[model samples]
Target: MSRIQANLLLTLIALIWGSAFVAQSHGMQELGPMMFTGLRFLVGALVVLPLAWREWNYLAGRQLALNRDDGLKILGLGMLLTLGAAMQQIGIKYTTVTNAGFLTALYVPLVPVLGWLLLRQLPHWSVWPGALACLVGAFLLSGAQSLEIGLGDSWVIASALPWGLHVLLIGRVADRMAAPFLVACGQFFVCGLLALIWGLLFEPFSGAGIQAAATPILYTGILSVGVAFTAQVVAQRYAHAADAAIVLSSETLFAALFGYWLMGDRLAPAGLAGCALILGSLLVVQLLPLLQPAKTSSEVLPIK
Candidate 1:
């Protein structure tokens, strides 16, 4: 659709994703990180499978061959997503909600840089300034007190790398397949399968944790994964990868605001400044293309 519609879509996605952050954090109250993740993906996969199946009709006959490049690409993308989600969910347990929210949002800046190095294609000129602003916002938002990076901090760092890669993977594959199917079925299956293996092998899957997580886990499984992700599939289809990254990054703003409003967390001085930078960043990024007279949808219940 039009750019106006895209902005609206991204905004709604941001709001949903922001609210779900609280859900994800709460869901872990009873579930082990891995068990929670596995169960969520399993439920999400079941939710989206029918939609993905509808898209399969487009790939008839030999197009569906296992040896096809699309098959391999989709598989590889799924693996990276699995890695990112595992690190993020577990890392969230150790980090403050504020840090967890902004740290993960760093992937917005990471996308353009990774795309440049790997694809030999630089992002729009807006990316550099946006990255710097985001970095400053990150520093302030982090409240480092002297740049200390703890275990949880390190996990957040690790999570950014894969998430950036995940965006890159989606960008490459976006033009080649059914966006919804790739998002709903292909990538998710990979995530589900790998998480299943990880949970079974390394995690405690006792009934206590699983049952404890029943309500929150159920919230995460259905709304966060199932509904939010469907929005992402549709929305991302309408924008370029880098632009999509910025729009998705709006989650940081929403998350911080939501935390304060819902959890009684007050905004510190740094929080106030960080929030401004985020708002400024959003305004600049959104207006850049239009000011230059150039450039740039779904049930997409986007997650991040």
Candidate 2:
């Protein structure tokens, strides 16, 4: 693919993912967060299984075996994914999609900080400024007067830590895994199963609820998880790292647009400012290396 085509693919992926925020919020009207999360992830798992199997078969043809250690790593990744997805769904129930989109972008800044703390690697100087901007943006967006943040925004903010950890884990294990698609499938299966158990324990399951939520669930599960993710995997092979990041990070903008157009959601001026800062910070963090004269190229962070 040409760079332009690759970039368009990435942009499409971002659009799909951004619109999923609206889908998730709408789905909450029919099903509880736990049930919705469980069902969507289960559907996602089913959708991706064939692709993963195809990759697994190719690896097997090369005489590669997925070992016990890789299995454990995949399980760990799944657990983290489950937590992040659960928090996001629960937060969406109580927050506007606009708020959820910008807040979720916090993970972009949080990743380098987590890498520094966990691996003892120093972040580039730009990371510090980007992180600061995100912190300030989050504070303003939270609508805190004294020190109290809204419950839903708090959930979304807290979810960023787990997401950061998930990225770090992927960075550590991705190069070692024989089949990336298979690893993704294993993690999705684990996340789906865990959410399913939580739903069974705490939320009532209803066929009627599932039926009502079908459209939203299908959008999030099949398009967001299955198609968009696969497209990202393929497109990134042909895209410049920084170009892909810039395109994909427009997800917040798309989310706000979708929310406004579809549900008439609006943010206050302060909240809008916060969203701008957060988005700017993400760009700085992603493009910083490219701006530096001595740096060869930018590193590509994995998409959530």
Highest TM-score against the true fold, candidate? 2
Highest lDDT scorer: 2
Candidate 1 lDDT by residue in tens digits, 139-199: 6765667777556656876888888888766755755564555455677777877887788
Model 1: lDDT to the true structure: 0.69
Cα-based lDDT at residue 168, candidate 2: 78
* CA shift of 276, model 1, Å: 3.0
In model 2, the runs with Cα more than 4 Å from the true position are 293-300
Which regions in candidate 1 have their CA more than 4 angstroms from the true location? Answer: 1-10, 61-67, 232-249, 282-291, 297-303
Model 2 TM-score relative to the real fold: 0.96
Error (Å) of candidate 2 at residue 46 is: 1.8
How does each model score on lDDT?
0.69, 0.84
Question: Could you tell me the TM-score of candidate 1?
Answer: 0.83
